[model samples]
Target: MTAEKEPHLSVARTATSPSAVQVVDLFCGVGGLTRGLEDSGINVVAGLDSDADCEYAYSVNNDARFVHANLLETSSDEIESMWSAGAVRVLVGCAPCQPYSKYSRGTSKEDPSAPVLRFAKYVDDLRPAVVSMENVPAVSRHPAFNGFLETLASAGYHISWETLPASGFGVPQTRKRLVLMASRLAPIALPASNVAKAKTVRQAIGRLVPISAGEANKVDPTHRASALSAVNLERIRNSRPGGTWRDWPDDLRAACHKGESGATFPAVYGRMEWDVPAPTVTTQFFGYGNGRFGHPVQDRAISLREGALLQTFPQDYKFEKAETLRSFALVGRHIGNAVPVALAKQIGNAINSHLEKYI
Candidate 1:
């Protein structure tokens, strides 16, 4: 049966035989998870998301067909239609996680669990052979997660989860993520952490051509940093690796830093250490004042390309075409908000190994 109510997709994933497992990724922003899973030889067939702007990057970077639609509007029947007749099904997603992030704790006005609840419905309707999900560490604690557990239990799926750091999976940042896997085929588990092999800032972006504040690198598009004011330039000039605004001259300090609360958020206006993994990359990572985003020795903030590299994206990964107008705010959101490609690949590796056991 053809998809009538399904969100129209321009391209379809290559049809696979029933012996092969296919994946449909939900909330595929710029195709990070999809790309990583495909790299693991998992044959991700399609990805769906609400943002149409993601279409260009998502389609350009990955083989999966992009479906521009919200998960809330999607039905399980429509999802099942993407696969060949009687194909082994897998559902994977890293839902909108801002509401469950530690930074937005107690401040999320939206129902943070809406996506989780939606995901549960799809699992029940489709009853795929395997399921996978990743999100901020806090998601494991939310009430919605409990509801998700109940749904899986009712469906007779075995589950495993852990709050693992991104560095543990070779990402060049210390981002803690909650990864969960469930399967009706057999008990499954995420791969073991590899923290001892963690990549560092120097290892991730040390070889890229250096560009000053406001200057775009001639060789690469994402290698552009936001322009720094004269004051902020001097602020970074005086900043040391791992040092905060406290290292700046008192004359250059913001008013908020003079109060007793000065001790709070000491990481703000800080520079990253070259020898260590970066602090968690955030939505505002391109701005010098946003967390520890300043380059260790440079008198500028880390550039868009640097942030993406720190997130374990390939150096040539096309976020936007080089000719397009790439703003720091716009591109930064895509890089920082994505699942670090390295971490996603680790999850994919686990899924592949699990599938092989039953294959």
Candidate 2:
């Protein structure tokens, strides 16, 4: 593996022309990373994912085509064909992190390494001028990550990676991610946190008018909150910011919380503090019992639109249209799983700076 150097400012701050770059995002859930890359002036040609449902949001919000193919089933030629003849092919992805994420239990029987290894093999075959990946920090400890490292080094690419806190960049959540960048053109490294002060949850979603549980704002369908049962409603009423289930009257606490094992899971069923960054947006951020997702003042979990905002997705960024109904699980999954747009923009800017100097 290539020895990693400390991150430094890119050699040049100027961005190359957008036509000179072509990016293909693999396993793109709903185009979060691609949106940010486009905002940073990179041209994302298309996003490939196994979920056909992502077509609407990915294409509508990004103006990028969506390819419905399993990453494992895709070929190097298929992806390479999307590239412009003389442009810098920038390949990027965040493989599913279920195997390595501390937040999830197993969901699929497929080999966890299959996607990462396949992506690494693509980099080897195409030898794209630039490559980028983002995933839960735990992925760095997995053997698949090591294999990815070896593939890049053997391919003569200069590689660097770092554990970055999304809040430090611009996102208003405390999600930490493992980000890796590789380049055949130059030795590239991630930039330092450019924002002077971390943005808080209030700053991200405070302006939206409050809604009760089971209510959807008349103006924005995505601003709807999931309904809570009577008992769960009282439980949320009792909870405080960053508080655990222990505050609930014994009757309101779940049976799971009565045992000794409950001590280890204190981060759940709590409201977010308004002053600090919100807890990491998860796939179930709409559920009151899931993590510290409850709104600090509102007696309900954060809404889908709020979750997207906390992830730094633009306010006007569309997640659903006339054809797409409001489904929390579906839209929440897209918002939660998406890379924070601000963070991706930072990465894209760094790469553009590298290209300006080297190419």
* Per-residue C-alpha lDDT of model 1 across residues 153-196, encoded as one tens digit per residue: 89999999888888888898888888899999889988788667
lDDT of every model, 2 decimals: 0.84, 0.86
Model 1's number of clashes is 0
lDDT of 2 at 310: 96
Model 2 ranges with Cα > 4 A deviation: 1-19
TM-score of each candidate structure, all chains considered together: 0.94, 0.93
Q: Against the correct fold, how does model 1 do in TM-score?
A: 0.94
The collision pairs in model 2 are none
Q: Cα RMSD to native, each candidate?
A: 3.4, 7.4
Give candidate 1 regions above 4 Å deviation.
Answer: 1-7, 10-14, 105-109
In lDDT terms, how accurate is model 2?
Answer: 0.86
Worst 10 residues of 2 by lDDT: 1-10
The number of clashing residue pairs in each candidate reads: 0, 0
